[model samples]
Structure formats: C-alpha cells, structure tokens
Target: MTKPIYIHGSGCVSVQPTFEAGYFFDHVTSYTQNPVPALDPDYKAFIPALQLRRMNKSMRMAIFASRMAMQQAGITTVDAIITGSGLGCLRDSERFVEALRTDEGSLLNPTPFIQSTHNMAAAALALSLGCKGYNMTYVNNANSFESALLDAMIYLTEHPAATILLGGVDELGERTTQFWDLANYLKRDDATIPTPLIEQATPGEIATEGATFFVASQEPGDHTFGKIRAVETRLEVDAPEIFISGFLQRNGIEAETLDAVVLGYNGDSRYDEIYRTLGSSLFANLPQIAFKHVVGEYDTVVAAALFLALGIFQRQHVPQRLLLNHSSIPPILRRILIYTQRRGQNHSVILVEK
Candidate 1:
C-alpha cells in the first residue's frame, strides 16, 4: 500500500470573504442575477508591481495562492506543481476573442493570447518558485481538480520528493456569465430567494470562481491539515450509493464513522437531486454541509469544499451557515468525506482523516 499523503498547508481566496480566520459566511450575499466575484486579496505583499502589471486574473490568483501555501508550509521548493481549471483564463480569452472580432484578422496584442492557455497558471507558479521539477495542468471540466489531486497522490507514491504544490483555480468572465444567463444556466429573476445550497431552487445555477492551493507530502508536517486516505472517481456507475458504500468499506470506514459529509449542492434544481439523495439517505445522521450557495457553482468548486473541510478540522467547529442539519456533536473531528458530481457525471469520493 502507498503511504498516505498529508496536507501540510492550504490557502484560499473565495467569494464568501475568506481572507481572515473567522466564519466566512457571517452574512452570506445572495445573487439574483449577476455572478459573484471573488474576494480580492492584497497582491502587493506577495507579488511586485512590475510583474503584477502584466499578470492575468488566473495567473495572479494562482501565484498568490501558491505563495500563501508555501509560506504556511515554510518551504521554498517543491517536487511538483499542478493545477486544474475549468475555463483557464477567461479574462485573457475574452480579450483575444474581442480582438479577433474587432480587428478582423489584424495583428492583436499577444499578452492576452499568451496568458490564455490552461497550463499558464502552473507554469507561472513554477517560474515564481524557481523550482521546475514537474508541472502539469488538468482541464477535465468539473473533474479537473480531482484529476490534479490524483496525479499528486501518484507522484507522492512514486517520487522521493519531500513536497508538492497542487491547486485549482477558475475565474468568471462577463461574456461567459451572459451566455449562461441566456441559456438559463444562471438565475432568471426573483424566482426564489437565495438560501443554503441544499434548499430548493431554480433552473439556473450560481456562477462564481476562486482559487485554493495546498502543500502535500508523505510525512506529516507540524501543522498538517489532514491526510488523504483515498480518492475514487466513477464515470458511469449504475448505483452511486453502492459505489460510495464500497469505497468506505474498502477504506475500513462505516457510514456512521464520518464526522461530516461535504456535499456539492449547487442551487440548480436540475442536478442538486444527486447530492440530496446522498445527504438525505446515506449520510443523514452525520453533519451535512454545503458551500456552493456562498461561493456559487463552478467546475473546480470541489476545491473550495476541500478547503472548507480543512478549516473545520483545524477549528474543530462546524460553521453554522454551512450546516444542512442543526444537529450538533462532540468537537472532536477525525474524518470527513467529500462527494461531488456534475449532471450525474464525473462522480467523485474523497476520504480525509486527521
């Protein structure tokens, strides 16, 4: 068996005001029409002005989050750097598209075009760290982050390196948001007020984006967040419940043993049922939690869910805002499970223990 990979440090910049150490959703904001923007961080501290002037949104976010994770880990170099992103750099992509349309085949600025690639973030992090051992990026839509995570796990098992930096990042674009609204991927009007993600909602889903980065190693650090015991992905399973049960069983854990189950319940009435089935049936007695409503829905949203679980483990307290059940338990957290899917595809199960 492969040695367990431990999460030594984590950093997040999300939509629910998560820069500091308090409960992020003290006063959750609702979006009736517009997409939520990520909470901005002071980039000057980590990035210089000359470099920041040319960095795109994705690059900036990726570098900032990577630096934060490294600082927390108190390390300067890592064995590898990997990232997953749904839309790449939407800001730069949009610029390239607009230039193509307006210029009508004329030469346009290459800055946007250069930064638009999906692997640009990972490359930028490598350049910033000055350590270029191994770098990769995954663009597998909603499963992108999980794909990167699995790669990191494999690297930890095969390589003798001491550390690795892995992350997920996605940014909302104006044109993309507008397109989603037209296709009814976003909320239409005052159809229903925003509530917890698990609540009944409308045809549209909340569109938002952010970044989360973590440092992982085979040996546990002094301030380790948790250990990733196992990760399993199912493309098309006849019975998701059975698949999940088998996963827990293979990992020597029962349904009742999980301290909490982090679910990806976006407000989309169409797909939230998948999560509801698991939350209401299999993990009913455990403390059920969801974060999509606060940060909105995106392909790499599960990264945020992972960060939330880490926060819960560190504080040993469940935030009242994210709770799907009012039931309380002892303040001792030992294990957590995260389940997520998109349109009943790319179903994933992750087990983490402290």
Candidate 2:
C-alpha cells in the first residue's frame, strides 16, 4: 500500500481573493470578462522587490503561494519541489516571441526566454527556499496538476520521511488568449464568473489563471489538514462514471460514503453534460459543490479545487455559494471526492479525507 500523504499546508492565488486572510469561498469575486487575470497579492510581503520585478506572473504567483504554504507548514524549506503548469510563464513567452519578431537581427533581452520555460517555477521555488533535493515539473494540459500530485504520492511512498512541495501554476498569455479565442476555446458571450451552470450553461470556458501550492508529507502532524487517499488521471475516458467508480473501488471507497463531492462544472454547454450526468446519477444524493464558476477555468485550476477541498476539511462547513445541489448536506464533513475534466478529456479523480 502507498504511504499516506498528508497535507500540512496549502495556499492559493486565483481570480478570487484566495490569498487574503480568513477568506474561503464564502463571498467570491465575480468577473464579467473572459481571460481574467488572477487577483494580485502584495508580493513584497513574501518576495524581495528586486526579484518580484524580474519575475513574470506565473513565477510571482508560484513563489508567493509556495511561501504561504511553507509558512503555514511552519517550515522554511522542503526536501523536494514538484509543480505543474499547462502554460509556463506565458507573459514572458509572449514577450520573447514579440521581441524576436520586432527586433529580428538585433540582440534581444534574454530574461524573458530564460524565465519562459515550464520548469522555471520549480527552479524559482528551489532557489527561494534553498531546496537542493528532487525537483520536477509536469505539463500535461488539464492533467498537469494530477500528474504532479500522483508523483508526490509515489515519492512519499518510496521516501516515507521526505516532505515535498507540490502545486500547479498557470498564467494567461496575450497572443495565446487571442489564439484560443480564434479556436472557439473561450466563452465569448456571457463569460462571467459565478458562471451559469447546467441548463443555463453556455459554450466554452472562462479562461483565467492562478497558482496553488501544498506542503505534503507521509507523516501526519498535529496541524495536518488531511490526507490524499488516491489520485488518478485519464487522457480520455469513454465513461467518466465507470472511471470514477473504478478509482473509488480500487481505493476501497464507495460513492455513498463520501461526505461531499467537488465537481468541475465550468459552464461550457458542450461538455458540462459530463458533470451533469454524473451529478444526476452517481452524485444525485450527495452534497455537490462547484468551484470553477468562482475561480474560472484554467489548465491548473484543479489545483485550486484541491485547495478548496483542504479548506472544507479545515472549516467543516460548505460555503453556500459553492453548493450545486439541493441534497442534504453532510452534518460532519470528512471524506470528499473531487472529479474534474476539461473539454471531455484529461479526466481526473482525487480522493481526500480528514
């Protein structure tokens, strides 16, 4: 059996004020625009002004969130660092491409190119924390975060005494956003947060960006938030219900025993049916929660879902705004199953418990 991976701490920076003290999803910040930028936190509190000015949004968010996680875990450093980003340092990437295009033969600034790689966030975290242990980054579209999470679990199983920093970060790119728009991947009409769901759902997703990090270890501590029982991902699942059921059964858990479930309903009419079907059938009687509406949709947004799950475990109360069904809420929250997919692909299931 794999060793229990306990979450000692978590931090998130998203479209909502997730970095704010004492803020859960109780009151969410809404957006009327697509491709929304994450709410910025005061970076000076967590990073040096010189370093902050040199980093892109993704690096800044990643470093800040990781620091928050470290602070909550009461540790200045970790043994390893692992992160996932679907699009890495997007703004810097855009800058490099734009500069290269404009200044063909001239010497160009190399900072953007240096910071534009997908692994730079992990590198930045390692440098900031002085961690020289294992470091890795995954970039598999929507499955990116899950890949990192699964790796963390396996790493803990092999190195039971090791503590690792695991998370995901993604930022919006200007030209890329336009490309997504051209490809009909972004919701043009009615692109608003608190995004309309189910029958009222529209087409495409509300593109946004954010970062979420966690401090994980195999040993449960006095302050440990909860444990991740299992995590699984599929490139494409013909039937999400079957995939989810199999994952739960493998973990020796039944659908009916769950305290609540976090479902990814991003208000995309084309694919929200997947979640709708699961809700009305498998999760009909459970307290179903929706988060993408509040945080908006991004490749690594599911990292925020895991953050929300941990928050729920900590608070023991489900915010009314996140509730998606009329089912009887569990009196004592405990086990929660989070399932999410993007455009009917990259389906993932995460089972978490207190």
Candidate 3:
C-alpha cells in the first residue's frame, strides 16, 4: 500500500478574495458577458521588491502562493516542486507574440521569451527557496493539475519526500479573452437573465484564471487539510456511470459512504448532464456543491476546487454559496469527491478524506 498523501497546507489566489480573508464568499460574483481577471494580492507581503521586478504576473502569484503554503506547513524545504498551467505567463506570452508580430520577429527581448516557458513559474519558486529537488511542470490543458497531482502521488511512494509542493497556475491574456468572447465562449452581459453556462448551455464556455498551491506531506500534521486518497484521469470514457464507478472502485470508496460531492458545474448546458448523472444517481442524497459559478471556468479550475475542499475541512461547514442541495448531513465532513472535465475530455476524479 502507498503512503497517504496529506495536504499539510494550501494557498490560493483567485478572482474572489482568497489569501487575506478567511471566508468572504458570501455573495457570488457573476460576469454575465466578459471574462474577468483575478483579484491581485499584495505581492510585497510574500515577495521582495528586487525579485518582484524580475518576475511576471504568473511567477509572482505562484511564488506568493507557494510561500504562503510553506509558511502554513511550518516547513523550510520540500523534496519536490511540481506545478501545472494551461497557459503559463499569459502576460509574457502576449508581449512576446506581439513583439514578434509588430517587429517582424526582430528586436524581441529575451526576458519575455524566457518567462514564456511553462515551467518558469515553478523554476522561480525552486530558485527562491534554494531547493534543488525534483521539479516538473504539466501543460496538458484541463488535465494539467491532475497530472501534477498523480505524479506527486507516485513520487511519494519511493522517494521518502516528507514534504512536496504542488500547484496549478494560469493567467488570462487580452487576445485570448477577446477570442473567447468572439467565439461566444464567454457569457454575455445581461443582468436580467442567467448566463448560458447556467441556462441555455453551448459549446462555448466562460473564461477565468487563478492559481492554487499546496504543501503535501507523508506524515499528517495538526493543520493537515485531508488525505488525497486517489486521483485518476482518462482522455476518453463513457458518461457518468463508468467514470464514477471506476473511480470509486479504484479508491475503494463506495458511493453510499461519500460525505460530500463537489461538481464542476460552470453553468454550461452542454456538459452539465455529466455531473447531473452523478448528482442525481450516485450522489443524490449527499451534500452536493459547485464553485464554477463563483470562480468561472478555466483549465485549472480543479485547483480552486482543491482549495475549497481544504477550506471545508478546516471550517467544518460548507459555504452556503457552494451548496447545490438542501440536504444537510453531520457538520463533520470526512470524505469528499471532486469531479471535473473540460469539453467532455480530460475527465478527472480526486478523492480526499479526513
């Protein structure tokens, strides 16, 4: 049997207030028409001025979140640093692309080019911590975070890495946001009616970006969020039935024992049925919750879900904003199942328990 991976500490930076405030998600923010940027955190608090000048937005966010997680974990070094990003350093990528276009591929600065790599953020974090351990980054679209998580699980089996740092980071770019809007991948501004993702539903989807970091350890600590029981991903699979059953069997979790189920319902009618199948059949009576309504849909949304799960474990209370059903079980939530997918591909199931 593999060692249980415990989330010793976690940190997140998103459109909603996450870093400073403990619980401020009373009112869910809606962007009925456009993609919104994540709320910026005070980088100076977690990062120094000299370092901040050399870092891009994604790098800064990753570093800050990682530092916060490490502080909460009460540890100085980690055995490995792993991260995932759908689009790493969008700001830097935009700058480099524009320079290549306007300057006809000439007079381009090497700074943006260097930072545009997907692993730059992870590299920066490792450098800042002076950590010379295993470092890796995943960029497999929606499965990016899950990929990193699965690797972390495998690494802990043989490496004896007491503490590991894992994270997912992404940023919204101007042109990409514009393209999404043009393709109707974004919700339109209409306060009188709910967005399509919540109602009409279509192939187009909402766009948002943020990052979440966690310090995972083999030994459980006082502040441990929960144990990552198992994680599985598939590129192609039948709808809800096979997916849920496979995950539960692999992890030895029966449907009836699940304490809570978190679904990635982004209001998109196109794929909401996938989650609905689980919600109605397998998790009908359990406390079901959703977060895309609050954080918006991005490749790394699962990272946000992980943060929310940890928060639920810490508070022992489900935020009313995330509740999808009225059924209230015992306040102590022990097991949580997080299900997420993008465009009917990259299906992932992450099981966590106290």
**The best candidate in terms of lDDT:** 2
User: Total clashing residue pairs per candidate?
Assistant: 0, 0, 8
- lDDT value, candidate 1, whole model: 0.82
Query: How high is each candidate's TM-score?
Result: 0.94, 0.98, 0.94
Q: Give Cα distance to truth, residue 286, candidate 3, Å.
A: 1.1
Q: Model 2, 143-236: lDDT tens per residue?
A: 9999999889889989999989999999999999999999998999789988999889988999999999999999999889999988899999
lDDT of each residue in 128-208, candidate 3, tens digit only: 898899999999899999999988888887676458999999988998888777876665643111233334555555677
| Candidate order (lDDT) | 2, 3, 1
Expressed as tens digits, the lDDT of each residue in 63-170 for candidate 1 is: 888888888888888989988998899988998989999999699998889998999888889888887688999998889998898888888888846589989999
Model 3 TM-score, all chains together: 0.94
Candidate 3, run of 10 with poorest lDDT: 190-199
What are the RMSD figures for all models against the true structure? 2.0, 1.0, 2.2
User: What's the residue-level lDDT of 13 in candidate 2?
Assistant: 95
Candidate 1: misplaced stretches above 4 Å? 21-33, 191-199
The TM-score, computed over Cα atoms with residue i paired to residue i, of candidate 1 is 0.94
